[model samples]
Target: MEQATLQTPLGMATILGDRNGIRAIRVTDHSEGEDSIPPALAEACGQLREYFNGERTVFDLPLAPEGTDFQQTVWQALLGIPYGKTISYMDLAKQLGDPAAIRAVAAANGKNPLWIVIPCHRVIGSDGSLTGYAGGIHRKKWLLNHESANPQQSLF
Candidate 1:
């Protein structure tokens, strides 16, 4: 599979995929960008950069995230969530025609392979507090704040 690790405001986002589509995009700390970027990953890499630069709000890429059918459904539903918006797990569950599936929905959300692209960070506790994220709660906060329409101004 084609691969590339690029630096971003969150961290080193390691993207893995090939001509079929993007398989995964995960963020980690203090890693170097790949010395050689694969041709297949050029567009995905470029799009991610644009997202961080606030030049792009929506992603258009051939994504091939591997997960169960239910998980796939959850991820697709996640895409419906607009940029700079938040959705409670309850709302997400209700949208899927299963209000009782909140835990199942949240579980599937946690397993989302595509990070920022999937916008799982937009899902929060029903009370509006940031909830658990595979990338850590702190990273979730940073991501939400980054995409905020009314961005919090620095006290400095």
Candidate 2:
């Protein structure tokens, strides 16, 4: 596994990846040292910078998130969410064909590791309020605002 951290307007983000793909991207309070950047980490950082600069929409990188089968299914479902769109947890549950699993869907969403790439920030409360995000609600709002301001030209 390789790791690198970058400071963004929202906060410091730590990205972990391997030759297979990016595994995780999470916000952390600590800043990483210059020497800590691996070659793959540099590529990931560059992509993230491009994203923040509004030059990139979809990410082109490998992703290998570690999670259970159900968690992986939920995270994969998140990839279907459009860049500027938002979905309720209940909606996601229904999409999964399990309306009774709203809490389970929310739990799986909370466990998503690939943050922006998976687009977990697109999930919101049924009442249209921003809900829990591991990265922080402020960052979640920032991501949503960013996407809304710079809508993607093409989803694919």
Candidate 3:
């Protein structure tokens, strides 16, 4: 249940983690404290900085998002989305083997707590238009545009 807040391109982000892994990473407009940064928090911040700088993709840090089984499944499916690609909620529902569960899938996505890491931002409307994001559609648009404009360079 450790937390740290830092500024990000889209806004300030509040990162929460425990010894097990990161529980959530939320975007905010301000920081909450000035205490010394914990080691895990610093490491997470470093990884986030690398991500924003376009130097990292596929984060290796641990994560432990709190959610229902269905939500967890939806979040895992989101992880499969490639960095610069986008998918529709309907497509995601189909991938879950329940085409009619598009609304449920969208609900799960809306509840995603890890933000950019779990990449709920990559989910769009059936018309290929950006839709709901807890962090705001503007941030979602910026994230999509950022990934598109800065294609990752392979480290291998």
**Count of steric clashes across candidates, in order:** 0, 2, 0
Residue pairs in steric clash, candidate 3? Answer: none
Which candidate has the highest TM-score of all?
A: 1
All predictions: root-mean-square deviation over Cα? 1.0, 5.1, 5.0
The TM-scores, one per candidate, come to 0.96, 0.89, 0.91
Displacement of residue 4 (Cα, Å) in model 2 is 1.0
The residue ranges of model 1 lying beyond 4 angstroms of the native Cα positions read none
TM-score of 3: 0.91
> Per-residue lDDT for 1-156 in model 1, tens only?
878999998889999999999999988987775547789999999999999999989999999999999999999999999999999999999999999999999999999999999999999999998889999998998888889988887799
Ranking 1 against 2 by TM-score, winner: 1
Clashing pairs in 1: none
CA lDDT of each candidate?
Answer: 0.93, 0.86, 0.88
Candidate 2's displacement at residue 73, Å, is: 0.5
Give the Cα error of residue 18 in candidate 1, in Å.
Answer: 0.7
Model 2 has an lDDT value of 0.86
Candidate 2 lDDT by residue in tens digits, 1-156: 888887867768888887778999888666655346788677778889899988888887878999999899999999999878999999999999999999999999999998788898999999999999988897898899899966445457
| Per-residue alpha-carbon lDDT of candidate 3 for residues 52-117, written as tens digits (9 for 90 to 100) | 998987777788999999999999999999988999999999999999999999999999999888
Ten-residue stretch with the least lDDT total in model 3: 28-37
lDDT of 3 at 63: 83
Question: Who wins the lDDT comparison?
Answer: 1
